[model samples]
Target: MQRIAVLTSGGDSPGMNAAIRAVVRKAIYHGLEVIGIKRGYSGFIEADMWPMDLSSVGDIIHRGGTILRTARSEEFKTSEGRKKAYLNVQRFGIQGLVVVGGDGSFRGAEIFNSEYNLPVIGVPGTIDNDITGTEYTIGFETATNTVLDAINKIRDTATSHERTFILEVMGRESGCIALMAGLAGGAESILIPELRYSIDEVCEKLIRGYKRGKLHSIIIVAEGAGRGLDIGKQISEKTGLETKVTILGHLQRGGSPTAFDRNLASRMGSKAVEALMEGYRKHMVGIVADKIVISPLDAAFKGKRTIDLEIYNLANILSI
Candidate 1:
């Protein structure tokens, strides 16, 4: 392929800039021209793109969020919109494409490739880590660390006031963040959507901990499982204990990416360009067992990524 274009879609995630930098430098190293698509598929439809060089992505290896930016394009879901995108692809003489984002982004790439027969490679980049096939998505480790830090800080105050603190972390459809952070933070209880949990059970755990002379309690709740305010109120009513709620929200999505994330993004980003150049279309670059692996793009988003029940059980046992 003589030319390739790259874009970041879906929600912004840390280490995305690192991925972008890798794609540009790697493509240039291969003597191929690189185009940066702004605002994702919306940019494609509007032909909002520019040629990228080495300096175009300089000093962004540790930055969070995407340099190309991203946005949801309702129009891109329709055939007419995709046709417009394809027209731009032809206009630019693009030979292949690299998509950096999460499950939804991969799905879009898969469909676009099917219709246009364009070569496309995907690089997973979401904090949710909900994408299948890949053991871990790009921003997961950094986000988990962010949550762990917040939990540590919150625990200090919870102990000082001898109160219960319910922390709500990001995870609208997955519990990976809550489960990981809760386990690492030594939370007394963790409520996740994957496993049904009752307020009574949570309160009982808190009461048991207190009976054993525990001064404070920390509970991690995935936003998908329940709201912190609602769960906190229920626990307070049932246990007659002081309760406080802290929602980490988008705070988990920002900050300089951790070393693990930067390395992962760089590896995956370079692999994506290599995949396209190797004539592998509709495929995703993932890291498994500390090695880079490639899988069909559809495989990354075809099924749900399940929580590690073994780890969940261990967390429960250790917390008790």
Candidate 2:
């Protein structure tokens, strides 16, 4: 029987558990012994592992975060650490490994596969949605939904107080989450890392809204777009308008997987299994145009995928 190991790394996001559950079930159904690695690259070096079965993954599809948990370990970067990890894999008799994480995880997978000849499969699990090979990652949809919920609530408070609230969502380098959530939440202005805006322009917009007798305004800013608090201060100083700022932190990564995420995870997980069975190794399972596909792990690690400019422009047009 084939032995496989799986782990999640980097920042946690919604639907990670669902992906893990799918990996376990799909691998086991294919007559492979599945092992769950605790923590992340650290667990691999420390040899922290546990047996995973259907029962162990029961009811996790609806959960958030990860059942096996996650962390960042610099050990994976060191040659010694890589060697130790290779020894551990052999010790456990693991043949194929699955990693669910963002770009950092993909980098580690590429190095591990290149140096040790270990076949590693990557599943995009970051809220940033910055991984190039995948059109949409597992946690991105749920994170968008979570931000929308918060944006709605903030809108209510802003309207009541007649205040202009600047809401900040997390998406370190990639603006995918901010773009989608801002568009869906009907934000008046969206600031994304991919697009830079003039502070004077934003103030002018606020001034225009005030002239139009708009009581409240919602401006969504990506964390990496700039600085939410700084922007709010600037707006308050420029427009002499009362402003409130809300930063949605890990809250975006802690909700139950949405219907879309559950379905996507199941499909991606199953496809990953099929790819392995077909003798395709060292790849990432990604969804492009609603179809399951595999891309080279190295390619995913090399390219920088940011928010699509056309989509961002369309969002601006539609918002107008």
Number of the top-ranking candidate, with lDDT as the measure? 1
lDDT of 2 by residue, 1-320 (tens): 38889999999878888888888899888888898999999999999999899999998889888989899998889999999999999999988888999889989988899998888888888888888888888889999999999999998999899999998889888788888988888888899888778889878887887788888889999898888899999999999999999998889988898998888888887777677777777999999999988999876768888667787787777655
> Please, what is the TM-score per model?
0.99, 0.97
Scored against the true structure, residue 125 in model 1 reaches a CA lDDT of: 93
The models' CA-based lDDT, in order, is: 0.94, 0.87
Candidate 1: deviation at residue 243, Å? 0.6
Look at candidate 2 and give me any clashing residue pairs. Answer: none
Q: Compose the digit string of candidate 1's lDDT tens values, residues 10-117.
A: 998999999999999999999999999999999999999999999999999988988899998889888999999999999999999999988888888899999999
Alpha-carbon RMSD of each model: 0.8, 1.2
Over 4 Å off in model 1, which ranges? none
Error of 2 at 34 (Å): 0.8
